[model samples]
Target: MYIPELYKNENAEEIKSFIKTNSFGILVNQTQGKLWGTHIPLELETNLQGKEVLFGHISKENPQGESFTDNNEVLSIFNGPHSYISSSWYDHENVPTWNYIAVHVYGKIRIIEGEELLFAMKKLVDKYEATSKNPVKIENLSAETMRQINGITAFEIEITDIQAVHKLSQNRDDKNHNTIISELEERKDNNSQAIADAMKKQRS
Candidate 1:
């Protein structure tokens, strides 16, 4: 994550909050000299030792799941809304660019199983199901259905480093930034509107 000083987001709490909101992220690592990646839902948590950790699960069939080992380094990427920024929106001449928010978390991986895996699965279900009108309880599953949980692999990552960036027209003047936001909001695409909202929140 090559981030310019103007766009870098160094606030630890803010970064953690972003990850919590956008828990579905890409987990990447190298296996047999080849790069492997998996799209998984993850959460930022504190371990019993009071250290920040990441928890997630992968399909048993995914080779990346088997590749993880104790202390193996991995990268988790969380992406936020983004859209094209036209140079015409700027008060001064500028090149077209993409504005977005992203966070890169580097950590050491540790595979988890049995009761620990069940605990992690429960946490994931509770987090997403909280917004449902009628949340489904994981414990409600029958014994046979619960046995299917073994088909997934659970893992934890102890966060070692974090890098985040919010490229929301920070290089432009107030007027130009406002122009970009207005243009984005006027567009029909939800992604554009999302970027507009992010820019507004940052400025506010």
Candidate 2:
């Protein structure tokens, strides 16, 4: 991730919360000497043995599924809010940059099937469906609809390492930092406002 010391975030709880909030991530792996990546929703969880892991699935037709062999390692990237930071907002002359948060997780793939796969799918569905006005339950699906699970490859990744970066103008002085937050908040876009909020939270 090439994170500088100034921008690195080492707080475990914070990083976990970030991942849960931004669970849709990019899963990267190599198959047949070619690197493949898939954008999917991953759930951070603890396995029966108390080891941290990520659970997700992809269609069986996806070529990336070929990479899910024994001992195969993979990389999952989770991105958070980001916004441009104009140098004009700083008290002194400086180059413009971007403020953002991201996480990189590396792990070994473990293909799951039978009840394990069904359980994983249930959890994934329940999590996202919570926000719906009329939330749908996986158990309520018809047999024909449930048959679609046969076409997917569900797997878990035993986490080996996690790297988190939070570049929110931490290098700036208090005056400049406050100014940057103000400028970001003035912008109407969601990313800008999110950066502003994150900066405030960091200071808090």
CA RMSD of all predictions: 1.7, 1.3
lDDT (tens digit, per residue) of candidate 1 on 90-140 = 777768999999999999999887776777778788888899999977888
Q: Write the per-residue lDDT of candidate 2 for residues 64-181, one digit (tens) a residue.
A: 8877884379999999999999998877888999999999999999989987787788888899999999999998999999999999999999899999999999988899999998
Best model per TM-score: 2
User: How does each model score on lDDT?
Assistant: 0.87, 0.91
Off by over 4 Å in 1: 48-50
Clashing pairs in 2: none
lDDT for 197 (candidate 1): 92
In candidate 1, which residue pairs get closer than 3 Å at backbone N, Cα or C atoms, i.e. clash?
none
